[model samples]
Target chain A: SQELEQSPQSLIVQEGKNLTINCTSSKTLYGLYWYKQKYGEGLIFLMMLQKGGEEKSHEKITAKLDEKKQQSSLHITASQPSHAGIYLCGADWTGATNKLIFGTGTLLAVQP
Target chain B: GAGVSQSPSNKVTEKGKDVELRCDPISGHTALYWYRQSLGQGLEFLIYFQGNSAPDKSGLPSDRFSAERTGGSVSTLTIQRTQQEDSAVYLCASRPDSNEKLFFGSGTQLSVL
Candidate 1:
């Protein structure tokens, strides 16, 4: 089964600092989605990138896909305490059903 | 409902009991999916339903797990004779026709003791 490797597995940063989380895959991704999950809560959709080298931003967060569509990075600028959560990246590569294979996830802790 | 809705936000059952989790996708959406999330783990694909096509159940962990979509709108996931390791967050998501965005439900937290 295809899987995504997200690193660093966990990160802690100052509230005003910038942080970047990376998700890498061996196979080409048809679609990549970024989501945030709070403890004991559902995942919140953040962004989706399909086209190679595509970049999308929402608020202070930005997501970019590599030219090969096999790697993606999420960048958060001037993070706040509210930015602390488990970040997960899901991808579709099989071209099968709408099922997505997710990464192990990055746990971000922003200290105020 | 404005977004995906799941019933029984939390479930606690005995190890040998059967459990059912329900999900109602967004209105008019054609694609529905179920995934399991263990603590500190990624989402595990379970099943998918698209239109009237046969559902894809390739991700189910075992025969103890089964899901069904009725009338193209709602879905139910059943776990029979659950084990202690069956505890996890069951998440449901729905995507509209020709779209990549998947709206997710709040998920049901299942714990088998």
Candidate 2:
């Protein structure tokens, strides 16, 4: 089984502060996905990176897949209270038949 | 529905009882998935259905857990003789295919007591 480790299990930042979360996998990732969730709510899809050295950004949030495809990072700029939520990194387990293996998750709290 | 929909937003069942959770994927979607989320843990992959065929089911924890997708649309995850450890949120998701973005349901909070 492939394992994904995320750093800083939880974080708290004041509004307008920038922050970053990292996701590292035990194996090379074929596809990396990002999702955000509010407590007790469904995960909201953010972005997907399929190629090495790929980078995608949505609004203030940006995600990048490393050249080795074994790590990824999510960066938020000028964060706002609305950015408070749990962020999860998922990977297409390569030969695992399309089921995404997910990381433990990072909880973000933004104070205004 | 606009997105994946799961039934019984919350369920409280006694230990050893059988329970079935439902998932209704978005129309026209050929891929549906079931995942379990325990408190403070990541989303655990449970099962995947692609066009009525389950090419992967290794994520199922035990024989007590089984899921079925019918007509390539709706899916049901049943836990036979549920245990206290089964207490968690059951989430359903769907995507266009293995390479696309996934949309998830709010999930059903299951409490086995």
Candidate 3:
């Protein structure tokens, strides 16, 4: 049903430039997670936000969940070549399934 | 301290045949999941197994798609009478618990001709 939507299907930036990716959901998000996958590989977990208005950071990546509880943003500061990959956002809705519904993804190209 | 692992990094098969993919989750991890990723597409949830309980098969695309996890460790996904539409990278993931972050495997690339 495409509950989650992401913007800027693809993005390119200089190696040192900063970038932001957005994710919005039609339904309230019970849990929000961000993951990155390189070419032909598995996704690596980046961060997760459960409560609205919560923010978390890892290294140069900072993620925030809006207080409205239907949106999230991933910010990468001082991006590097290694940051090139597909970034996916997944949401866990209310249910016993707890299954993750993923967005199409955002392809990030960090040009050196 | 190894992460999840999948066997047969790549598989090429013809239609009407059967294929089996294996996944070995991290030791002691109780939650396991199977997902499929079409080329340049988002991950598609297939099935999930938590410990020794009954698996949640609601996401399976069809009756031909079935999976089993034995002894709460190794798991296998089987597809019978495969079609070209079944071609995709099958990914496996595991987490210590339902609330923890998932650890994924490299995945098995299946090409059904």
Interface RMSD (Cα, Å) for model 1:
2.0
Off by over 4 Å in 2: none
lDDT of 1 at A30: 89
- C-alpha-based local distance difference test score of model 2: 0.90
Candidate 3, residues A1-112, lDDT tens digits: the string is 2788987789999999999999999988888999999997679899999898999999999999999789999999999999999999987765546676788899999999
Quote each prediction's TM-score: 0.95, 0.94, 0.92
- Give candidate 3 misplaced runs (Cα > 4 Å): none
Q: Please compute and give the TM-score of the first chain of candidate 3 against the native first chain.
A: 0.95
Query: Could you tell me which residue pairs clash in candidate 1?
Result: none
Fraction of true A-B contacts recovered by candidate 3: 0.58
Top TM-score prediction, candidate number: 1
Q: What are the runs in model 1 whose C-alpha is more than 4 Å off?
A: none
Docking verdict class for candidate 3: medium
Q: Please give the TM-score that candidate 2 achieves against the real structure.
A: 0.94
lDDT of 2 by residue, B1-113 (tens): 88788999999999999999999999998888889999977889888888856447888999999999877888999999999999999999999877788889999999999
